[model samples]
Target: NSSDAFLLYRVNEAIRKSGAVVEFVREHIILENMVSIFGNTEKQAELINILFLPIVWGFFHIIKAFFSTPLSALSDKIGRKVTIIFGWTIYTSVYVSFALIVFLPSHIQIPVTFVLFTIYALFYAFTEGTEKALVADMVPEEKRGTAFGMYNLATGVSTLPASIIFGFLYTYFEQQFPGYGGTFAFGFGGSIALLSMILFSFLVKAKNR
Candidate 1:
Protein backbone atom coordinates (compact mmCIF):
# COMPACT_ATOMS: atom_id res chain seq x y z
CA ASN A 1 0.00 0.00 0.00
CA SER A 2 1.02 3.59 -0.59
CA SER A 3 2.12 5.61 2.42
CA ASP A 4 -1.04 7.69 2.46
CA ALA A 5 -3.24 4.62 2.27
CA PHE A 6 -1.25 2.90 5.00
CA LEU A 7 -1.52 5.89 7.29
CA LEU A 8 -5.25 6.12 6.67
CA TYR A 9 -5.70 2.43 7.38
CA ARG A 10 -3.76 2.64 10.60
CA VAL A 11 -5.68 5.70 11.72
CA ASN A 12 -8.95 3.95 10.97
CA GLU A 13 -7.93 0.87 12.92
CA ALA A 14 -6.74 2.91 15.87
CA ILE A 15 -9.89 4.96 16.03
CA ARG A 16 -12.34 2.21 15.01
CA LYS A 17 -14.13 1.91 18.32
CA SER A 18 -14.17 5.64 18.95
CA GLY A 19 -15.59 6.65 15.59
CA ALA A 20 -19.15 6.05 16.67
CA VAL A 21 -18.56 7.90 19.89
CA VAL A 22 -17.17 10.91 18.08
CA GLU A 23 -20.06 11.02 15.64
CA PHE A 24 -22.63 10.71 18.37
CA VAL A 25 -20.87 13.37 20.38
CA ARG A 26 -20.57 15.73 17.44
CA GLU A 27 -23.97 15.21 15.91
CA HIS A 28 -26.17 14.16 18.77
CA ILE A 29 -24.50 15.76 21.76
CA ILE A 30 -22.49 18.82 20.73
CA LEU A 31 -24.53 19.94 17.75
CA GLU A 32 -27.88 19.52 19.46
CA ASN A 33 -26.68 21.34 22.53
CA MET A 34 -25.16 24.09 20.43
CA VAL A 35 -28.40 24.63 18.60
CA SER A 36 -30.11 25.21 21.86
CA ILE A 37 -27.37 27.63 22.87
CA PHE A 38 -27.53 29.65 19.69
CA GLY A 39 -31.04 30.27 18.56
CA ASN A 40 -29.80 30.97 15.03
CA THR A 41 -28.74 27.42 14.22
CA GLU A 42 -27.39 28.09 10.74
CA LYS A 43 -25.05 30.88 11.80
CA GLN A 44 -23.58 29.01 14.75
CA ALA A 45 -22.84 25.87 12.73
CA GLU A 46 -21.47 27.86 9.85
CA LEU A 47 -19.03 29.65 12.12
CA ILE A 48 -17.89 26.42 13.72
CA ASN A 49 -17.48 24.76 10.32
CA ILE A 50 -15.41 27.67 9.11
CA LEU A 51 -13.13 27.54 12.11
CA PHE A 52 -12.60 23.77 11.84
CA LEU A 53 -11.85 23.81 8.13
CA PRO A 54 -8.70 25.88 8.64
CA ILE A 55 -7.47 23.53 11.35
CA VAL A 56 -8.15 20.54 9.10
CA TRP A 57 -6.65 21.85 5.85
CA GLY A 58 -3.78 23.92 7.17
CA PHE A 59 -0.26 22.72 6.24
CA PHE A 60 1.55 20.74 8.92
CA HIS A 61 4.92 22.18 7.96
CA ILE A 62 3.62 25.68 8.57
CA ILE A 63 2.38 24.72 12.01
CA LYS A 64 5.46 22.68 12.79
CA ALA A 65 7.75 25.51 11.81
CA PHE A 66 5.72 27.93 13.86
CA PHE A 67 6.10 25.82 17.00
CA SER A 68 9.56 24.36 16.46
CA THR A 69 11.64 27.50 16.05
CA PRO A 70 10.78 29.04 19.41
CA LEU A 71 10.94 25.73 21.28
CA SER A 72 14.32 24.86 19.76
CA ALA A 73 15.64 28.21 20.87
CA LEU A 74 14.08 27.90 24.31
CA SER A 75 15.71 24.49 24.84
CA ASP A 76 19.13 25.98 24.15
CA LYS A 77 18.62 28.82 26.66
CA ILE A 78 16.47 27.63 29.62
CA GLY A 79 16.85 23.82 29.44
CA ARG A 80 14.25 21.07 28.93
CA LYS A 81 12.75 20.94 32.41
CA VAL A 82 11.58 24.52 32.36
CA THR A 83 10.22 24.09 28.86
CA ILE A 84 8.31 20.95 29.81
CA ILE A 85 6.91 22.43 32.98
CA PHE A 86 5.81 25.49 31.07
CA GLY A 87 4.26 23.34 28.35
CA TRP A 88 2.45 21.24 30.92
CA THR A 89 1.17 24.40 32.53
CA ILE A 90 -0.36 25.50 29.26
CA TYR A 91 -1.71 22.00 28.64
CA THR A 92 -3.39 21.90 32.04
CA SER A 93 -4.89 25.33 31.50
CA VAL A 94 -6.40 24.26 28.17
CA TYR A 95 -8.16 21.27 29.75
CA VAL A 96 -9.40 23.45 32.57
CA SER A 97 -10.89 25.85 30.04
CA PHE A 98 -12.55 22.97 28.21
CA ALA A 99 -14.13 21.76 31.42
CA LEU A 100 -15.39 25.22 32.21
CA ILE A 101 -16.98 25.70 28.82
CA VAL A 102 -18.58 22.29 28.80
CA PHE A 103 -19.90 22.38 32.33
CA LEU A 104 -21.05 26.00 32.23
CA PRO A 105 -24.64 26.79 31.36
CA SER A 106 -25.51 27.10 27.66
CA HIS A 107 -26.49 30.72 28.08
CA ILE A 108 -23.00 31.98 27.11
CA GLN A 109 -22.01 33.45 23.76
CA ILE A 110 -21.42 31.01 20.88
CA PRO A 111 -18.21 32.79 19.90
CA VAL A 112 -16.78 31.93 23.30
CA THR A 113 -16.43 28.29 22.30
CA PHE A 114 -14.33 29.28 19.31
CA VAL A 115 -12.12 31.41 21.56
CA LEU A 116 -11.51 28.41 23.82
CA PHE A 117 -10.66 26.25 20.82
CA THR A 118 -8.15 28.82 19.64
CA ILE A 119 -6.58 28.80 23.08
CA TYR A 120 -6.39 25.01 22.87
CA ALA A 121 -4.56 25.25 19.56
CA LEU A 122 -2.06 27.70 20.99
CA PHE A 123 -1.33 25.44 23.98
CA TYR A 124 -0.96 22.45 21.68
CA ALA A 125 1.56 24.31 19.55
CA PHE A 126 3.81 24.96 22.54
CA THR A 127 3.41 21.56 24.21
CA GLU A 128 3.67 19.50 21.05
CA GLY A 129 7.11 20.78 20.13
CA THR A 130 8.51 20.97 23.65
CA GLU A 131 7.32 17.47 24.50
CA LYS A 132 9.41 15.80 21.81
CA ALA A 133 12.46 17.82 22.72
CA LEU A 134 11.99 16.86 26.37
CA VAL A 135 11.76 13.21 25.38
CA ALA A 136 14.93 13.46 23.34
CA ASP A 137 16.69 14.97 26.32
CA MET A 138 15.56 12.18 28.68
CA VAL A 139 16.09 9.12 26.47
CA PRO A 140 19.51 8.29 25.12
CA GLU A 141 19.96 7.95 21.36
CA GLU A 142 19.82 4.15 21.36
CA LYS A 143 16.67 4.08 23.48
CA ARG A 144 14.89 6.84 21.60
CA GLY A 145 13.36 4.42 19.12
CA THR A 146 12.05 2.24 21.92
CA ALA A 147 10.70 5.26 23.74
CA PHE A 148 8.75 6.44 20.71
CA GLY A 149 7.53 2.92 19.95
CA MET A 150 6.15 2.58 23.45
CA TYR A 151 4.47 5.94 23.17
CA ASN A 152 2.78 4.97 19.92
CA LEU A 153 1.74 1.63 21.32
CA ALA A 154 0.22 3.20 24.40
CA THR A 155 -1.77 5.67 22.31
CA GLY A 156 -3.06 2.91 20.04
CA VAL A 157 -3.99 0.55 22.84
CA SER A 158 -5.78 3.11 24.95
CA THR A 159 -8.09 4.43 22.23
CA LEU A 160 -10.31 1.36 21.98
CA PRO A 161 -11.59 1.37 25.54
CA ALA A 162 -11.49 5.14 25.75
CA SER A 163 -13.77 5.47 22.77
CA ILE A 164 -16.11 2.76 23.94
CA ILE A 165 -16.45 4.27 27.39
CA PHE A 166 -16.98 7.74 25.97
CA GLY A 167 -19.51 6.39 23.50
CA PHE A 168 -21.46 4.69 26.30
CA LEU A 169 -21.46 7.82 28.42
CA TYR A 170 -22.41 10.04 25.51
CA THR A 171 -25.38 7.90 24.65
CA TYR A 172 -26.37 7.34 28.24
CA PHE A 173 -26.35 10.95 29.39
CA GLU A 174 -27.56 12.36 26.12
CA GLN A 175 -30.60 10.14 26.40
CA GLN A 176 -31.20 10.77 30.08
CA PHE A 177 -29.80 14.31 30.17
CA PRO A 178 -30.44 16.71 27.34
CA GLY A 179 -27.04 18.42 27.19
CA TYR A 180 -24.59 16.70 29.47
CA GLY A 181 -22.41 14.46 27.29
CA GLY A 182 -19.85 17.19 26.68
CA THR A 183 -19.85 18.04 30.37
CA PHE A 184 -18.94 14.45 31.17
CA ALA A 185 -16.15 14.32 28.58
CA PHE A 186 -14.73 17.63 29.69
CA GLY A 187 -14.84 16.69 33.36
CA PHE A 188 -13.35 13.28 32.74
CA GLY A 189 -10.52 14.61 30.56
CA GLY A 190 -9.81 17.55 32.83
CA SER A 191 -9.83 15.60 36.11
CA ILE A 192 -7.49 12.96 34.76
CA ALA A 193 -5.18 15.59 33.29
CA LEU A 194 -5.07 17.49 36.57
CA LEU A 195 -4.38 14.29 38.51
CA SER A 196 -1.69 13.31 36.03
CA MET A 197 0.00 16.67 36.43
CA ILE A 198 -0.02 16.35 40.19
CA LEU A 199 1.34 12.80 40.08
CA PHE A 200 4.04 13.61 37.59
CA SER A 201 5.02 16.75 39.45
CA PHE A 202 5.78 14.65 42.55
CA LEU A 203 7.22 11.63 40.80
CA VAL A 204 9.26 13.08 37.96
CA LYS A 205 12.63 14.61 38.76
CA ALA A 206 13.94 16.62 35.86
CA LYS A 207 17.64 16.36 35.08
CA ASN A 208 19.84 19.40 34.62
CA ARG A 209 20.95 19.67 31.04
Candidate 2:
Protein backbone atom coordinates (compact mmCIF):
# COMPACT_ATOMS: atom_id res chain seq x y z
CA ASN A 1 0.00 0.00 0.00
CA SER A 2 2.56 2.57 1.08
CA SER A 3 5.10 1.21 -1.30
CA ASP A 4 2.62 1.29 -4.13
CA ALA A 5 2.21 5.06 -4.18
CA PHE A 6 5.80 5.37 -3.16
CA LEU A 7 6.69 3.33 -6.20
CA LEU A 8 4.69 5.55 -8.52
CA TYR A 9 6.14 8.80 -7.21
CA ARG A 10 9.63 7.38 -7.28
CA VAL A 11 9.13 6.65 -10.93
CA ASN A 12 8.67 10.33 -11.56
CA GLU A 13 11.36 11.52 -9.17
CA ALA A 14 13.42 8.35 -9.03
CA ILE A 15 16.41 10.49 -9.59
CA ARG A 16 15.68 13.01 -6.86
CA LYS A 17 18.38 15.53 -7.70
CA SER A 18 17.35 15.61 -11.32
CA GLY A 19 15.90 19.03 -10.79
CA ALA A 20 19.40 20.30 -10.06
CA VAL A 21 20.72 18.86 -13.28
CA VAL A 22 17.92 20.42 -15.30
CA GLU A 23 18.37 23.70 -13.45
CA PHE A 24 22.04 24.17 -14.31
CA VAL A 25 21.72 22.91 -17.82
CA ARG A 26 18.91 25.37 -18.44
CA GLU A 27 21.02 28.13 -16.96
CA HIS A 28 23.94 27.40 -19.25
CA ILE A 29 21.78 27.10 -22.31
CA ILE A 30 18.77 29.42 -21.96
CA LEU A 31 20.11 32.03 -19.56
CA GLU A 32 23.39 32.43 -21.40
CA ASN A 33 21.55 32.76 -24.65
CA MET A 34 19.43 35.51 -23.16
CA VAL A 35 22.47 37.29 -21.78
CA SER A 36 24.21 37.36 -25.13
CA ILE A 37 21.10 38.48 -26.93
CA PHE A 38 20.53 41.25 -24.44
CA GLY A 39 24.23 42.09 -24.54
CA ASN A 40 24.64 42.05 -20.74
CA THR A 41 28.41 41.68 -20.88
CA GLU A 42 30.96 39.26 -22.32
CA LYS A 43 32.73 39.13 -18.99
CA GLN A 44 29.69 37.51 -17.47
CA ALA A 45 30.43 34.33 -19.40
CA GLU A 46 34.06 34.34 -18.34
CA LEU A 47 33.03 34.93 -14.74
CA ILE A 48 30.64 32.01 -14.81
CA ASN A 49 33.16 29.69 -16.39
CA ILE A 50 36.05 30.77 -14.16
CA LEU A 51 34.32 31.13 -10.83
CA PHE A 52 30.55 31.03 -10.41
CA LEU A 53 29.71 27.59 -11.80
CA PRO A 54 32.30 25.79 -9.73
CA ILE A 55 31.35 27.52 -6.51
CA VAL A 56 27.70 26.77 -7.11
CA TRP A 57 28.36 23.08 -7.75
CA GLY A 58 30.91 22.88 -4.95
CA PHE A 59 28.50 24.40 -2.50
CA PHE A 60 25.79 22.00 -3.63
CA HIS A 61 27.92 18.90 -3.00
CA ILE A 62 29.22 20.36 0.24
CA ILE A 63 25.72 20.92 1.50
CA LYS A 64 24.51 17.52 0.36
CA ALA A 65 27.47 15.70 1.88
CA PHE A 66 27.22 17.63 5.08
CA PHE A 67 23.53 17.20 5.71
CA SER A 68 22.54 13.95 4.02
CA THR A 69 23.29 11.76 7.01
CA PRO A 70 21.72 14.15 9.48
CA LEU A 71 18.61 14.48 7.41
CA SER A 72 18.37 10.72 7.01
CA ALA A 73 18.82 10.49 10.76
CA LEU A 74 15.96 12.90 11.01
CA SER A 75 13.87 10.65 8.82
CA ASP A 76 14.51 7.85 11.28
CA LYS A 77 13.51 10.07 14.17
CA ILE A 78 10.50 11.70 12.60
CA GLY A 79 8.94 9.62 9.80
CA ARG A 80 9.80 8.76 6.23
CA LYS A 81 6.52 10.01 4.76
CA VAL A 82 6.81 13.41 6.35
CA THR A 83 10.43 13.98 5.41
CA ILE A 84 9.96 12.58 1.94
CA ILE A 85 7.06 14.95 1.48
CA PHE A 86 9.27 17.72 2.78
CA GLY A 87 11.86 16.91 0.15
CA TRP A 88 9.26 16.87 -2.58
CA THR A 89 8.08 20.23 -1.33
CA ILE A 90 11.59 21.51 -1.76
CA TYR A 91 11.73 20.07 -5.27
CA THR A 92 8.44 21.69 -6.31
CA SER A 93 9.45 25.08 -5.01
CA VAL A 94 12.83 25.01 -6.68
CA TYR A 95 11.36 23.88 -9.97
CA VAL A 96 8.82 26.67 -9.84
CA SER A 97 11.51 29.19 -9.04
CA PHE A 98 13.72 27.95 -11.83
CA ALA A 99 10.81 28.27 -14.18
CA LEU A 100 9.98 31.76 -12.97
CA ILE A 101 13.53 33.08 -12.76
CA VAL A 102 13.27 34.07 -16.38
CA PHE A 103 11.05 36.91 -15.29
CA LEU A 104 13.72 38.44 -13.10
CA PRO A 105 16.21 41.01 -14.33
CA SER A 106 19.32 39.55 -15.90
CA HIS A 107 21.59 41.14 -13.28
CA ILE A 108 19.96 39.32 -10.35
CA GLN A 109 19.46 35.97 -12.03
CA ILE A 110 22.97 34.71 -11.28
CA PRO A 111 22.78 35.22 -7.55
CA VAL A 112 19.23 33.99 -7.44
CA THR A 113 20.22 30.94 -9.42
CA PHE A 114 23.02 30.30 -6.97
CA VAL A 115 20.66 30.43 -4.03
CA LEU A 116 18.22 28.06 -5.72
CA PHE A 117 21.09 25.75 -6.53
CA THR A 118 21.98 25.53 -2.86
CA ILE A 119 18.39 24.93 -1.92
CA TYR A 120 17.95 22.28 -4.59
CA ALA A 121 20.81 20.29 -3.10
CA LEU A 122 18.79 19.83 0.07
CA PHE A 123 16.16 17.75 -1.77
CA TYR A 124 18.83 15.12 -2.32
CA ALA A 125 19.89 15.15 1.30
CA PHE A 126 16.32 14.65 2.33
CA THR A 127 15.17 12.03 -0.16
CA GLU A 128 17.98 10.18 -1.90
CA GLY A 129 19.02 7.49 0.54
CA THR A 130 15.92 7.87 2.64
CA GLU A 131 13.94 6.56 -0.28
CA LYS A 132 15.83 3.30 -0.13
CA ALA A 133 15.48 3.32 3.61
CA LEU A 134 11.76 3.57 3.00
CA VAL A 135 11.69 0.38 0.99
CA ALA A 136 13.33 -1.33 3.90
CA ASP A 137 10.93 0.32 6.29
CA MET A 138 7.87 -0.86 4.36
CA VAL A 139 8.59 -4.47 3.67
CA PRO A 140 9.27 -7.65 5.62
CA GLU A 141 12.94 -8.42 6.02
CA GLU A 142 12.43 -11.50 3.85
CA LYS A 143 10.55 -9.51 1.22
CA ARG A 144 12.95 -6.62 1.20
CA GLY A 145 14.97 -8.11 -1.60
CA THR A 146 11.98 -8.24 -3.93
CA ALA A 147 10.84 -4.81 -2.78
CA PHE A 148 14.23 -3.31 -3.48
CA GLY A 149 14.40 -5.06 -6.82
CA MET A 150 11.08 -3.54 -7.80
CA TYR A 151 12.20 -0.21 -6.46
CA ASN A 152 15.37 -0.26 -8.47
CA LEU A 153 13.47 -1.38 -11.52
CA ALA A 154 11.06 1.54 -11.20
CA THR A 155 13.98 3.92 -10.84
CA GLY A 156 16.00 2.65 -13.76
CA VAL A 157 13.23 2.16 -16.28
CA SER A 158 11.41 5.38 -15.50
CA THR A 159 14.48 7.59 -15.52
CA LEU A 160 15.24 7.45 -19.21
CA PRO A 161 11.72 8.28 -20.40
CA ALA A 162 11.19 10.91 -17.76
CA SER A 163 14.43 12.59 -18.63
CA ILE A 164 13.60 12.56 -22.30
CA ILE A 165 10.14 14.04 -21.84
CA PHE A 166 11.28 16.72 -19.39
CA GLY A 167 14.10 17.81 -21.65
CA PHE A 168 11.76 17.89 -24.56
CA LEU A 169 9.31 20.03 -22.61
CA TYR A 170 12.05 22.32 -21.34
CA THR A 171 13.69 22.85 -24.73
CA TYR A 172 11.24 21.90 -27.41
CA PHE A 173 8.12 23.31 -25.82
CA GLU A 174 9.95 26.50 -24.98
CA GLN A 175 10.92 26.86 -28.59
CA GLN A 176 7.34 26.24 -29.59
CA PHE A 177 5.79 28.41 -26.88
CA PRO A 178 8.50 30.99 -26.26
CA GLY A 179 8.25 32.43 -22.74
CA TYR A 180 5.77 29.80 -21.69
CA GLY A 181 7.92 26.76 -22.34
CA GLY A 182 9.61 26.73 -18.94
CA THR A 183 6.36 27.67 -17.34
CA PHE A 184 4.81 24.60 -18.87
CA ALA A 185 7.76 22.29 -18.29
CA PHE A 186 8.70 23.17 -14.75
CA GLY A 187 5.22 24.11 -13.71
CA PHE A 188 4.04 20.74 -14.83
CA GLY A 189 6.85 19.14 -12.89
CA GLY A 190 5.94 21.10 -9.78
CA SER A 191 2.38 20.01 -10.17
CA ILE A 192 3.42 16.40 -10.45
CA ALA A 193 5.63 16.68 -7.40
CA LEU A 194 2.85 18.32 -5.43
CA LEU A 195 0.37 15.72 -6.52
CA SER A 196 2.75 12.94 -5.62
CA MET A 197 3.33 14.34 -2.17
CA ILE A 198 -0.36 14.63 -1.57
CA LEU A 199 -1.00 11.15 -2.88
CA PHE A 200 1.74 9.69 -0.75
CA SER A 201 0.26 11.30 2.29
CA PHE A 202 -2.97 9.51 1.58
CA LEU A 203 -1.77 6.14 0.38
CA VAL A 204 1.51 5.08 1.97
CA LYS A 205 1.05 2.90 5.07
CA ALA A 206 4.77 2.35 5.56
CA LYS A 207 5.53 2.47 9.25
CA ASN A 208 8.45 4.63 10.19
CA ARG A 209 11.16 3.52 12.55
Q: Across residues 1-209, which tens digit of lDDT does each residue of candidate 2 receive? A: 01122111221231222333324434677765644553345454434343444555677789889989999778888889888989989988987776676666554555676677677778889998889999998888999999999999988887777666676776787699875675677777778788988998899887856
Q: What ranges in model 2 sit over 4 Å off?
A: 1-51
Q: Which candidate leads in TM-score?
A: 2
Candidate 1 deviant stretches above 4 angstroms: 1-65, 100-110
- 187 Cα displacement, candidate 1 (Å): 1.3
Considering only N, C-alpha and C atoms within 3 Å, which residue pairs clash in candidate 1?
A: none
lDDT of 1 by residue, 59-143 (tens): 4335545666676567557766566566556556655554445444333423444454454445556665655666666788999
Could you estimate the TM-score for every candidate? 0.60, 0.73
lDDT of 1 at 95: 50
Residue 111 lDDT in model 1?
43
Locate the minimum summed-lDDT window of 10 residues in model 2: 1-10
| Backbone atom clashes (below 3 Å) for every candidate | 0, 1
